[model samples]
Target: MSTFTENAPGVAEQSPEAAAGFTLNHSMLRVKDPERSLHFYTHVFGMRLLRKLDFPEMQFTLYFLTRLLPEDSVPEDPDERTVWTFSQRGLLELTHNWGTEDDPDFAYHNGNDAPQGFGHICFSVPNLESATTWFEDMGVEFVKRPGTGKMPNIAFVKDPDGYWIEIVQPDLTAGLGR
Candidate 1:
């Protein structure tokens, strides 16, 4: 069986100096309905909308969101807000193509069916059990419930766009003795 090692054949080596100050800014997902997608993200995930940009010429819009801690401060100026939004980690970008919501047959491929490629995004919670219970109460759709799958502690929930959102506690692997 093939397994990955530190110096694996396909691994690209990077020095600390070369990779400094690099952070995952965001991962984007296309949504059909901005209203429903925004509601699900902000209400269900408790993420605040950081910025929204509209492109009339391109006929689409982009919504940037992030989960802000109580201590985090948001800039009031538009330019400063843009800078602040880009610097934060774990941002979610929702892209909406105009008029997709109006078409009854329109749907984005969720990457879970046949010919799959893109996978799920995850969120770490303080308590897995409580989070799953809260998700249940909020009428969120579950792709898999905790304790039912091979990895019993993890759960998968769907966003308004049907993209999977993995739910896990911070100590997930530690408890498994990995």
Candidate 2:
């Protein structure tokens, strides 16, 4: 089977509704431990908690995080925060199903294995060498150290959840100026 969508000439050509404004909203990951994921994202990666929603009956909670501007602040009110969080782009959503972290055998397939699907998330730094050094200083685990991968200037590291996060230095690794 194909992974892409097939389109009919007329219906898939274009439409007014399809042309509406679009934003690359947020990407969600199922985290085993909320505390660990939260710490990694907030302290290590420097993302702010935009909002959190808990469902007691469903036994799960959702955490919305994003890297906001220095001047931007999340509202204290729940409604306002939800509205604001969804309105922005480039957000990360961490979903925690209660008790998953406590299970000794539970593991979410990271999709880079034999079945191969979701590969990794990435962050671009101003300088690859400096960033990789900083990650080392912080005791972060490395899947592929800087200057060692197929893309030598780029690096890949594993998070607490065993999810791969690729790091690149724009203008050096990816050939795009930051």
Stretches > 4 Å off in candidate 2? 1-17, 174-178
Model 1, 19-74: lDDT tens digits are: 76788999999999999999998988899999998999999999999999899999
Number of backbone-clashing residue pairs for each candidate, in the order shown: 0, 0
C-alpha positional error of residue 90 in candidate 1 after TM-score superposition, expressed in Å: 1.3
The residue ranges of model 1 lying beyond 4 angstroms of the native Cα positions read: 1-9, 16-19, 175-178
Candidate 1 vs. true structure, TM-score: 0.90
Residue pairs with backbone overlap in model 1: none
Residue pairs clashing, model 2: none
Q: How accurate is candidate 2 locally (lDDT)?
A: 0.84
